[model samples]
Target: RPAYIGERVVTPRTPADPTADSDKVVWSQTVSLLLGALCEKSWDTEKV
Candidate 1:
């Protein structure tokens, strides 16, 4: 794969066993992204 200028690749290794700590981090990210999406939707609706 050719790398483009300023392009970066990130790889995150998964744990052999899913632990509570890792799950919590993933869940928190999910929640934050969901909230951001919801907020954007509401803001767009309000602007309409």
Candidate 2:
């Protein structure tokens, strides 16, 4: 877990774990879903 040190959260002290192509695909999908949800909420449907 990451720790908060007053103003900033402490970065990981070790190297990042290796991720495979499948992991990247899943991560991008998750990110796109979150971005889409945010855009939908911010869009004005009545004006569309």
- The lDDT for every candidate, in the order shown, is 0.63, 0.55
- Residue pairs whose backbone atoms clash in candidate 2: none
Instruction: State TM-scores per candidate.
Output: 0.60, 0.50
Residues 1-48 of candidate 2 have per-residue lDDT tens digits of 754332131232332633444455566678779989888877867457
Which regions of candidate 1 fall more than 4 Å away from where they truly are?
A: 1-18
lDDT of 2 at 24: 54
Please report the candidate that would top TM-score against the real structure: 1
lDDT of 1 by residue, 1-48 (tens): 886322321222444545754665676678779999999999999999
